[model samples]
Target: MGRVLFVTPPLTGHVNPAVGVAAALTARGHQVAWAGRPEIIRRLAGDGADVFPCAVPRRLPERDASLKGPAAFRFLWEEFLIPLAEAMAPGVRAAIGRFRPQVVVADQQAIAGGLVADGLGLPWITSATTSAELVDRLAGTPKVAAWLDELLDGLRSRIDGGPADPRMSPHGVLAFTTRELLGPATVPHQVRLVGPSIGGRAPTCDFPWDRLDPAVPTVFVTLGTTNADAAGDFLRAAARGLSRIDGIRTVIADPGRAVGPMGDTVLVVPHVPQMAVLARVDAVVCHGGYNTVCESLWHGVPLVVAPIRDDQPIVAGQVVDAGAGVRLRFGRAKPDRIAAAVTRVLDDPGYRSAAEKVGASFRAAGGAAAAADHLEALLSG
Candidate 1:
């Protein structure tokens, strides 16, 4: 059995997928160690994998918090990334040396993993939570492109004495999204579409599968764990949109205190087992994160995606094109428009049928087991 070191972002979205891969590795008798935050470390430990804490800033000070908008974006670039990267570099290097891993699997956010792997002359794999091309595509835009260039330049400067070009990094990229979602692009030879690594032991909670009335079509609303604040607004808008629908029950999973009171048809809960819930729902209203999209597709549930930020737009666009979902402009969204979209999705049977086909394909891909097999092959090679 080979020693594998998995590095992930502090956020749950990134950590959860990595944990899935780690669990698979451990099951296969390979030694798996993860470097992440304390909470994630605990979760990884629970999965029977050794955990190492990556010394990145897991929480921001209350005084330093900025409301989401242009200000948040600016703060992320200027205040967050610069300092966080600097502080994290030593921890990444130390972990790599101490673990002496045969292979390093890292999230895209932890660019330091790639740098450390390169310096140590070890094999490195890049795992993406969303579409792999998200950063590159965003950087290609005319206005925001410059900022992306500067960010890359800054990362390069931190790595080497002088600014290092991003193209010089030699690491294999593994996208956790499907080809249908990522679209066709001339990705690097090292880049591979490994499908979504979303495996986990079934939740302890007793999901109310029996209570779901199949006669009345159901829509599951989830904003994901990280961006629950944005999801709350969507739930309110969707509640208004679905209010008039006679036989539709909307289930909103709001773990982040974003969801509020809705009509009789809408059920608000702190959290629900996503896959279990998706299994019972006819459709999903989501933020279009790769994990959620893949879960929805895996369950054959059609989608109404309101992409709030980041790679959400890309995922939303792919689902829409595949005839499995509808992508709405989040900025201009209102209750009526959202309702109309939901109506269109539910009224048509084709969307659900198409989604089921994709779900079958996703299931056949073998999820994290396949991913582990690939990593094992890489380690041996």
Candidate 2:
């Protein structure tokens, strides 16, 4: 059995996918060590994987805090990536000195892991929960992307002790999304499409899924755990859109600060087992994150994607093109538009039909087990 070191970012979205990969490795009798923030350590420990805390420069920001999207991205780039890489440079050296491993698997957020692997002359592989070129593609938008790129380049220079090189893409990048959504032209040979790595959680929730009224179409709205503040706007739009539809019920997940004021047809809950809710719901209105998108597809539920930040827009576009859903711009999103999109998805059978096909293909791709097998092959070779 080969000893492997896995490093992930502090965010739940980034860390969740890695948990499944680590668990799969452990189940295969390989020794796995995790380097991440405390929360990630706790999560990995809960899954029976050994944990090693790798302190990032700044803790993840509160879910509801208000900051301009660009500014927030800049803050993450500077505080977390730059300083974290500098700090980890030494820690990684020390860790290599102590527990030497054959290979390192790193999430895209933990670029330091790549640097450490490079420094130690070990093989490095990058695992991404979202699209790999998401930031670079978004940077094509005139001043906004340019400004962000400049900031990131500066950070890279500081971390690497010199100017940033344009050839610095991750050594081997693995994306969870499929080729259909990402398009053949967009993905390069270096990036491997491994399908979605949605961990090994059984559908064991005891929620009353059968109780949901079938006569009235159900719409599931979720913004995930980290970004509940964005839910308020989405929920308000959803309530306005679905309020007029007869017998329609909307269930929201993580309605935290957005709970108090809701439409009569909407049910507000702090958390709902997403897969359970999706099993009963006809359509999903979401922020287009990879986990939620994959979950919605895995359940064969069509999507109404309203992407706010990061790679959401790209995912939203993929959904729209694949006939699985429609994409709505967050800034231009309105109640009528949301309602119309939801209605289109629920009323038309084509969307759900297409979604089911994608879901089946995803299932056939072998979920977590296939990913683990791929990792093992890489290690053995």
Candidate 3:
């Protein structure tokens, strides 16, 4: 049995996909451990998970909510990704020394895992939780692409890594999405479309099941874990919009406490048992976070995607292109627009049909088990 180490960032979206793959590896009699924040790994992966602690920034860099497009992209790499890799390099090296695994599974955002593993000549797999980069958003912008390349080169120099992009491993890339959502984007041979690693998450919240009215159409509203700061107005707007519609009920995951009080038709909580909620919801109103979008589609539910900064715009566009959802502007979307989008997705069977088709493709792609199979092949090859 091969020993595998999962290197992940503290972000929930990145770590969640790896959890299912790790479980699958363990089930196959292989040893699995994680290199990331112990609290996050343990919370998501479980209490029994062997976790090697990595250093994260003292505080996440604060960015203006107004930053978008190229500016947002630059801010992410400069303030977050670069600083994160620098902070985590030492700890990743330490984990490698102590664990001495045959292969490392690194999250796409956790650059240190790939850098340290590549430096040590260990085979590392890239776990792409989102399909944003696979489509190449920077294709036309040569200057931006060059700038990113130079930035990565500097980071590589600091970590003593080889001249390779950490985001795409030479060994393999486990993309948690199918071609159904990616459209005509060109992907490399090393990338495997393993779909969403859907299972093996331990629920973190106790949802009020009895409060849900099965008599009416239910919409699940969330902006995911990281967007609490910027989700206030959008969340409030969504709640207000969803509340006005007749025969429609909504469960809003208000982690930011953005939407204060609502009527009998709306249920607001800090967190939700997402998978459970998705199963029953008629539609989803989200910030186009990849995990949420994929999960919603995985359950054959449609969405109204209001994309925020970072990779969200790309993901939201993909949702629209796939015919699985409607898109709204995150900053500029008004209540009426939000309501109309949700209503359209709920009423029109085409959105649901498209979502179901995508969901079918996701299941056929073999998800976590397929990802594990690829990892095992990498070790044997």
Off by over 4 Å in 3: none
- The backbone clash count of each candidate, in order, is 0, 0, 0
Q: TM-scores for all candidates? A: 0.86, 0.84, 0.98
Worst 10 residues of 1 by lDDT: 160-169
Off by over 4 Å in 1: 44-47, 58-79, 132-135, 138-150, 156-169, 201-211
Question: Deviation in angstroms for 292 in model 1?
Answer: 0.7
Ranking by TM-score: 3, 1, 2
Question: Candidate 3's residue-wise lDDT over 172-263, tens digit each?
Answer: 89999999998888998899999999888777879989988888899999999998779888889988888999998899999878788898
Local accuracy of candidate 2 as per-residue lDDT tens digits, 213-279: 8787789888776676666766766766777677788876654656554656677667676766777
> By summed lDDT, which 10 consecutive residues of candidate 3 come out lowest?
130-139
lDDT of each: 0.72, 0.70, 0.91
Better of 1 and 2 by lDDT: 1
Worst 10 residues of 2 by lDDT: 161-170
Candidate 3 vs. true structure, TM-score: 0.98
When sorted by lDDT, best at the front, the candidate numbers are 3, 1, 2
The number of clashing residue pairs in model 2 is 0
Predicted candidate 1: what Cα RMSD to the true structure? 3.4
Which of 2 and 3 is ahead in lDDT? 3
Give per-residue lDDT, candidate 1, residue 274. Answer: 76
